[model samples]
Target: MSMHRTVTMLAGLLAALLVGAPAVAADNGLTVLAAPPASSGRMRLQVEVTDPALQKELRSSGASPDRFRVAVDQAGAQVKAVDRMADSSRERSYTVLAFDQSKSFATSWPQAFDLAEAYADELGARSGNHTVAVMTFGKSKSTHCEETTAAGLRACLARVEGRGTDQPVTRLKFYIQEAVREAARKQPLPRGGSREVIVFTDAGEESPALKVKDLARDARERGVRIHVVVFSAKSAGKGIAQRLDEMSQLAEGSGGRYIQVGDVDARQAVTGLVGALENLYWLDVAFCGVKPGQTSDRLSVEALVGQTPTAWSAPIDFRQRAEGTATAACPGTVVMGPSQAQSGTSAQPGTSGSANPPGATPGTGSPTQPGTVTGSPGTGTQPGGALGTPGGTQQPGGGPGAPGVSGGPAGTPGADAAPSGLPWWLIALLIALGLLLLIALLVLLARRRPEQAAAPAEKPVPPVAAQPAAPPPAAEPPPAQPEPPPAAPAAWKDPFATLPETRLVVSKGPPGLEPFYRVHKSTFTIGARQGEMDLAVNLPQLSGHHATVQLFKGGNVFVKDEHSTNGTFVDGRRLNPGERVQVRPGQIIRLSQHLELTLVQPGLQPAEPSSQVPIAAAPPSVPATTPPSAEAPRPKARTLYAPARGDDE
Candidate 1:
């Protein structure tokens, strides 16, 4: 055969073989809101998918659980099952799209508009039946659609004829604040609904009247995230760079994304954002290969989507299941289906579409720490005090040490670097709703596990047809055991990873701060320094060793000033050196100028009137319902264990 004929034959043969081969596994933007796994049995994960097509399939009735597969990196453990958290699975969304008409965008105006329309048109499809409002801003602003469906957005796009203003003094902060307000008008994000404002801008400006901080605060309060799509040229200018910084601030502060896309990838970026908004899941995963008391290795998961597979992984922060001395193998129940490789680079957090974090999913008993972990392992300079490695190494078995940071296990080259650093603001959900979610969860439990909730039925003994058993000779009294050695006066046995009953619910703090921190130590130190303090605060105003919260034997709480630069305050009074004071439930602990933590006690609400009364004016009898944190009654390691509950718990 001629050379050309032979090449054609080879190409045809290659195609025929390839058709039968399995699809390659790739990252599909799987975002896991990681929590320390249940110290033992199984891991419960709040998993969200940001793949447009896959999201639809995941929520559809057609999804087959068998098609999904999950695996862990450890030697023996694997994922047993994945369940859809009905309460956490989001269903609706709203978007406010504002395209910039600034002078800086003069060169890329046409391209910018094209990208905006493309983005709006696609997102308007309402994958999960979301609404979008399209508008334009430069010297002034124009609303094309305050609220519209996919069909409506397309209809209004024809009327959009926009370009940069001659004198563009963009009040970017005010612009975002307005957008967030519009979102708020829809009311607090309804269950299964997320709010977002996407600003397509090549440039920005902040007027003195409005500020990023204020906008961020507003957006967080209104349950709105602000995402900015920057269309940059290969040779961008300094002016553009400045605006990019401003855009980043707006995005970061508001728990949204700062997406950078060239013309070639606009579609992909927009698609990712769309999928991110409405597709979230809850996974009741049973981890395998867990050694008792020892922290297990990181975990990974995989799922097949049509011919291709997608992978995900998270660091092993799950508290060990077996307590103190024993080790247990990960319960690898239904053998994992397919092992998925860990790949980075592909997961971008810009549009995680989670709660404006530092929050929780309302109406559902979701992840106890629903806030996303997005802070870097560094000083206490900001929110998202994600579990980071402190100075000391964790001694084996539950010994004290600040070891291991949070995130999925480290990946090879090209893995994502921002896995654990989600903006804290995004995680702040409604705190008041937490009570309702808990009550509902308990009621549901009462219905589902009546046996566990109710008394076990007594079984009747068979009629004594058989002769009555003779009374056995009285057993000799057991030998008196030697008196157990007294526990060290200063030592206490702290449950390594289980959450303690004494938790500090952050009533007021930075954007992405953990809401409720389980305090397992009698003398739990709270401060800004990462490795040194038991509870690390991200706010910088506070000193390194700010204060200590001591929960004593009788549930009495006291706080002591650590001689911090910015003194700690209980209720409203500042603490003096060595002046330990008693504190009770419902009192607020203010650290420095920025953060405030509230003491939460179950079945324990302080006398509200007494708490409200002036400290000096009140009758001395009922002392502060609560003190700051730590002072006298200095106990050692904590003993009361309130393990962070997984969905199962």
Candidate 2:
């Protein structure tokens, strides 16, 4: 009976505790997205707020400039302007797709082409609204492609199916710089909204001709957002050495995202990109948080979301040099950070910069700006610029600035402040009510105990069970669960699904190239760009658009130099650009310095041609020096040339 009473009381107490849970609103899901430090002594950091209940992202609406608690390391900073990306695409947005197009990536160009075309078509499918431009970068520069309609853009993208120019892959820094500058000035006059550049590549060589800081500066000055998507995802983040790949490094420096590619296929990758572009946020802050003589690339941001300010993100590495603000802290606001403690300021706890000039608004601290920025992405508001309501009168908080009064203790900004939690009285009352219920349950159980005890006297038969109970048989051990079978090996998929048949294989190359490119296309370009070229050669000597190989039906072949920086050679003789030279399957073609390819037609042999270049072999019957005329030189090696076919013949 006593045991039963103890259990009942414990159950009652547990119920009471469950009823006293404090009401917690959504408070902790703020993420500081990206902060690209600008060379102009300014920085922009993007953030996204989430609805805990819905598990979806939302804007921190009506958040004024003062609501943000920014820092450079531990020092305080101020936000000069606030801008929200507007949701509606009332105006067309300009996006530039800058692809490095390295040959190392395993890209399915036909499939990728379809994916990209679908994207462009979808953008313009509705009333034919054109929205994107594409540029495949190489050694020098190639003109961007933008069409009047989706079909035109499709055709332009189709042109990407062939190989690109002869530009070396080592010029990553130089190429990105050029792309940024071009994006800034190339948009048509009609595009009045946001400008973005999606840089794609697997890897690249860093060139010193243009410094990283210079690239960051140009991206900012041009108001272009740099976002990178790489094919080899392993190199997307920091490595074991804590060093990022060149692609990611460049992205971080330019304040761009190193978008992760979950799947190797381009359809899935492109789809995710399109969706992210439509849903991301772009925020700018004039963070002056660095201390004197202190320089860092890490940025810190926080905002008032609860009883006090909370960190928006951990210190992020922007790669660009970040400097401190001249002022110690935003006037009247105490420095807030992950480690810094908050305390009362001189002005007052609840007052919003009350000591500022007569024009100052309470929480805003700044009286000069009328309203803070407000809009979703695709809106007309540009980043790094102010877009508040039309009320900047200096007469002490009389204009739209009054909207800032909602800011309260702990530097909470107006409507952006965290929602009020349940009242203390209501919480206390519920707890008391739970306690009363517990007491009633306990009393009911106590009263029922006596009744239960009084009615339980009919258990005389239980005495029969007292006869010595034999120890129960020792429990048998349960059978062991079967181990799962080893997983089946993944099936292999063909890398060259588009080719009709295997006509050529890379007989020699770096390791892991055992089954190099097996191309059979009658005429295809070969270069550093995988998607743009027929046979991608990642070697340094090969240019972006190196040469085009034409497979003659008779097993004869022609190699035409595409005006590559390094001339192509047939048996050591340099072939001029655009000049097609005939050669046989046994002939070796050289590109630039180190790359050599031996042509082969497995089961086919073409007609033997007249020896354009002399062979050194001499018949035994003929006198070595006198018989063969000096003009008819003997062939030192077994070299073969394709007979002139068709017009050449």
Candidate 3:
């Protein structure tokens, strides 16, 4: 179905629910629903919490920031208050609950729901009448671009929708200036009441109209608790996916959490948003390296806060490490510069310096303003009036001519290490060799073996004299070799765009079979193609680690070892997985004792007729049953099926 149609259907269902669903609570302002400001009224109440579970429950209950139930206590606390439903057209007041919105994750919908529940829980304890606002995307501006159509709208939404689809596939760009202008005109004045703007965008601005950084700054200045929902792009090939990745980075540059939507649950998304909308205790994390490990590009981190896995951050690249350093070994923390780290110091385990004011512990650190930097004498000035010039030079500490060396006297070096000049005989030898070119060529030609003789001498002669040779057969030219196939195409792209040309062949198995052939999980199987059975196991997605593959011909085993953050092993031996290693015919591939398989002949690279060399003669008499590896040495090239040649051509 078209994305637009799906959205419209959802909108209709929501509207229908609003109209038909009966009010469960009695009328006493018990059910508070906050509408998007029409002109900004008395400050609305926005609830921010750090609980993830509470946020999840409310979002699943179909509670919007503008709509949900709360109870008020009577004099003796026995009388329960009821809710007076507001007209759809009337001005509405509501409450907002943000759950763990401070987390730096691309996906946090689960947290948003938790926040909603927390707000409800808090409401249960209140003495007087209270209201709750569950933040949600209300209505989009009617400014229609060329994006009214499904494809166009999908593209447009790809730009604005928070964590809905893959960034690389979403070729979306909003006219920034136009969007900002529209946003400004449409936004109501702040109603002294508390309000939160939970933003769901890739934190990018492709539109020439809006400056995303400026917008974020404005939101922060205006007290808009901008909770971001990140959408990451999946890159497989060229063009769109690659550009989306760039766009995602641009969006994240503003310090907003980004969530990539690849095989991710929608409920998780909403919960994450709620978590951000409400202040949650989701732990912050940072990595030591830009990429997670030396070889793995993905950094899968699960926080064990309170003894539970809180959330996992999207994979960050090593390239980003150049701009900033990881604060610690934790994931989800911002990649901050050394200066930023200093200013934002907390009691985290690792940081450069620790600070202690009055009554503070010696080693315990607190946030401190960055210290001013002073340069040594004779330091060169940069274009921005900073010390240290681009080139290798030091300014004089004293006036222009004064020697400005600052770091103490230069240490004296040891005596000269060795002579610099080359011996005269080496040059003379080169000159002599240059003069003997003709003699050297003649010598080389004479020394050439018979097998290296000229092509003309190797041509076969026809036996015409023996029997008035038969008519020479017509010569046929050789056929050209085929090129390799292209890489696989993306599995999805608005599936309805075109018909499926290739067949999706799935293997059917016995009834009540377990889930086999998982995409990333490991599996074992026996080889059936060749005469001998070879055991093989496939492990696609390992524990955030990479493996190398190797084949040992002498040993009866083929091993895949773990050379990654998480190691892989075949039985007890670690074989590098993820790399291609050849297993010659007659070898047994072993994943340690865990799995085993014989290397079938048919699977090995076909031996070229011209490439294979004949086996060398055995020394005297040897056993006929001797193994292949123990056999006498053989020539590098062996003839396959070469046809006898004619002389005429």
Q: Judging by lDDT against the true structure, name the best candidate.
A: 1
lDDT of 1: 0.51
Instruction: Compute each candidate's TM-score over C-alphas.
Output: 0.33, 0.40, 0.24
Point to the candidate with the largest TM-score. 2
Taking the candidates one at a time, how many backbone clashes does each contain? Answer: 44, 26, 99
lDDT of 1 at 439: 58
The parts of candidate 2 lying over 4 Å away from their true place are 1-67, 73-81, 88-92, 101-112, 121-130, 147-151, 162-170, 186-193, 204-223, 232-244, 252-255, 259-266, 278-299, 307-311, 314-329, 334-649
RMSD in angstroms between candidate 3 and the native structure over all alpha carbons: 26.8
Q: How far does residue 206 in candidate 1 sit from its true spot (Å)?
A: 4.5
lDDT of 3 by residue, 276-327 (tens): 4323211112233222222222222222222122332222221122123421
Which tens-of-lDDT digit does each residue in 1-649 have in candidate 2? 6645555666656554443333132233444544544444566555544324222323434555665555544333457665554454553556676666544333523444555676675666453323577877655556567665777777778776565433455355676776776666765322334456776655554444666566665564455656666444333222211112344455655545554343234455455444444333444555433445545445555455433444244455553334434333333333323322121111112122222322333324234432222211111111111112112343222244432222221122343222223455655765676676667677767767754335545655544545787899999999999997655433323322233332434445544443433334467577665445656655544556788887645455778998764568888899866778777767777776556677665545322222542222333344333333457543443322211222121
Ranking by lDDT: 1, 2, 3
lDDT of each: 0.51, 0.48, 0.28
